[model samples]
Target chain A: MRLISLTAIAAITAFPLFAHADDRIEDALEARHGYMTMLAINMGTLAGMAKGEIEYDEAAASTAGANIEALGNYAVSDLFIEGTANGEVDDSDALPAIWENPDDFVQKFADLGEAAAGAGEAVKGGQANVGPVVQKLGGTCKVCHDDYRKKD
Target chain B: MAEDQARRVRIWDPALRAFHWLLALLVVANWLLGKFGPNIMTLHFWLGYSIVALLAFRLIWGIIGPESARFSSLFHHPRSVTGYLRDMVKREPSHWPGHNPLGALAVIAMLLVLIWQVGTGLIADPEDFVNVGPLANKVGSDIATKADAWHALGADLILIFVLMHIAAILFYRIWKNEDLIRPMLTGWKWVRRR
Candidate 1:
């Protein structure tokens, strides 16, 4: 009975993301940008705390880190819908390389999701501990962008 | 001293020579850092800043440094530049105490292109919003994008100018038996005194 109730709660929480997993979602370019912006915001908060630009607050760190973990694992395929790459659409920074090398693109996020999960947990430690993990999370953001994002 | 050794003149000064080699090393190192190790932003930015410092010194040196390092030495009249090019094609090695006319043009182009490269780098950013240059936040994202394009183009231009510069040195070394590289190091080149 207890295990069944725990599974039901987990399913209820995850159902929303799964429901919106439509591959042909509209305004995907904007959607993806919005998603990335959110990640960046949370990332900026953690980065600020890590760089001591913002005072270290444990609760804030934990929230931002967990937010990154959840966002990183969110279904990304729909957000990268076909024909939304730069030049194909207006103001798109999404490089054609993303579509050309879809496997590598998919793999990068998969790895980032895993890394974000670890970073999310590692950052739960006090002030001194968050810096390195924040850097690691930033690296995950960079490695993919370094390859897949439009440079200019 | 040997007859040819006696012909050696103090054309390049010590400061200019050191500046040449140090700038060369730093440019190569920084270029490699940009091309191969984009992830190494801290080191790359630090080296670039070092290049900017060296360039600043060079600018002052060009103004008031030795005759060899002066801006006056670099700008040959149009006729002289054309004549220099004409002589080179005829395999006539016209020797100057400082940069030869063709080399001077190459130097000017190189310095300009390098300046553009580093200048654009100040505001350059990938659209991905990575933690980047000092002026990344100062400019709008569109401007940063434009600068990034120029930055990449500038890098290629730098490489081409650098290659041409080296090729010119090698051409002099083998064909004309002129050791341009050594003078940059030793501050003296064996040239006809009269």
Candidate 2:
């Protein structure tokens, strides 16, 4: 009778855990994906100005830089919760390496924020400064993507 | 007296050794700047230019430097490379004053691939046209895009070659009891008496 009661309790707890797991994983995946998409859009604006393809409007560049900096400073760890890696969450491009090497992943994310802040400062310095900072910022994105994000 | 005379032989010249280490340092530093250093693209560009200049010097040195440093002295025919591998498998003693046949191939391969890497970098641009190469503006956007693709591909290839180079050095050290790294650093290798 004791064993039966214990088994009944285990089933009751395990079922709810399994039922909610998928929802939580999907929510985290969508949050991170949306965040990255926003970053890419702002990055595109800075890139255009840097390339001389778009006229160097100081205000526009500053706005884009600020946007990127704000996005980079977001609480990224909460968005990349456990079990949201590539196979675990549908539509997630995050590699399992991010979870396996959490400390390195966190460090790389911190680097992105720092680079973004530098880029924001560079935007006020005109074309020569903005161009290189944009490049440097892109490099930080590559560093994280290379190790933590899954390839298409 | 004979044993003492053969105890050490000059292999890599000072110029060659300097070139090897300086190039290695620049490559690693430039890679780090790209990956981690924001607001430092100016330094990255200067580093790339320096690498190009060093490579130019190496080319001329390969022609006129000491015999051991010359390409003609280092290169081997395919059959000779195969024979060297066979000898290696048989554990026969082979003491090359400079690079062995296989090492020669790696050196040449690295040089050629690096040439490709820098060449593409000269004409490429980062995404959305940011941080373009010096010559990128002169080329059409289509051509620059192509160069960008090749530049990325070349970077990966360089990484593979560098890893292979290190692994080979470690293998020689551990398996063949040859201290290849020390000779490169000191510009001298111990040769057995003939």
Candidate 3:
């Protein structure tokens, strides 16, 4: 009877740790999702203007570019903590390959930051400059997404 | 007498040849860009537009092009397709200057699937509401979602069909001693007079 009580106590104590870890993972996933969504929103605006699908409004482009550039400056490594890779969380598009090749994955983020900076500068120069810079910026996203993100 | 011994025929016209190779190149390049080139949707959109244009040309050409390139000349009845398959199993396949029955089916299938693929792309919206197709905004969110799903599924189907098409060409080359690819490249094939 004493042994049974001890086992029950251990189970009760261990449960919270698991729950806490899960909660942290969920938070991380939510943070990353918001980060990507913001990036996409900014990207879409720039892309629409670049393609002539929308009228080129310099103010809007500059604002979007600054947003992206700022977001790029974020320390994204913290946003993708342990247990955020695929299979660990629901709706995570991150592949295990990101963890497997940490250096390359991190390098892609660095590239994205650089490209975002270029985009910010290009937007100030107006339409012609924005297209190529946005292309470069998008390419960085593809680089990370192709290798590190899971396809749906 | 020596020249008469091997009769060579021009089966594929220059326009058809150019269309075939250009389409192949564009498809491969666009796929790479789609898979690996992010934010380069400008180029991606242009590539897709080119593909749609080429497909449109091909469709019209298939209707009114040369004798060998016409759909009426290539498409065969189901019985003929089944018969060709049976003969292929026996290692005694028939020959045509243009696509054979089975090859014809593959060509038609690929063209139709690609048309569907490009059509879906015209209305697809990636990332909820961002980076959408040109016509995506005109359609509602539900339709956009359906188009996106079909676009994703269509990409895989295209890959499968392309691989199978390559495998079939290789199979014919090794097993039946046919040079299907060579004819496509050179637009000429040696035909035996009956």
Off by over 4 Å in 2: A1-152, B1-7, B36-40, B90-93, B192-194
Clashes of 1: 0
| Chain B TM, every candidate | 0.90, 0.89, 0.90
Which candidate ranks first by TM-score, i.e. highest? 1
> Highest DockQ among the candidates is held by which one?
1
Q: In terms of lDDT, which candidate is strongest?
A: 3
Clashes of each: 0, 0, 2
- What interface Cα RMSD is found for model 1? 3.2
Better of 2 and 3 by TM-score: 3
Model 1: how far is A81 from its true place, Å? 2.4
lDDT of 1 by residue, A1-152 (tens): 99999999999998878666532343687788889888888888887787677888878888888888999789799888887888877778889999999999999998778878856667776778887776667667778876787766
Instruction: List, for all models, the DockQ compared with the true complex.
Output: 0.22, 0.10, 0.16
Specify the poorest-scoring 10-residue window by lDDT in model 3 chain A: A143-152
Clashing pairs in 3: A138-B38, A138-B39
Which segments of candidate 1 are over 4 A away from where they belong? A1-26, A125-127, B1-6, B127-131, B192-194
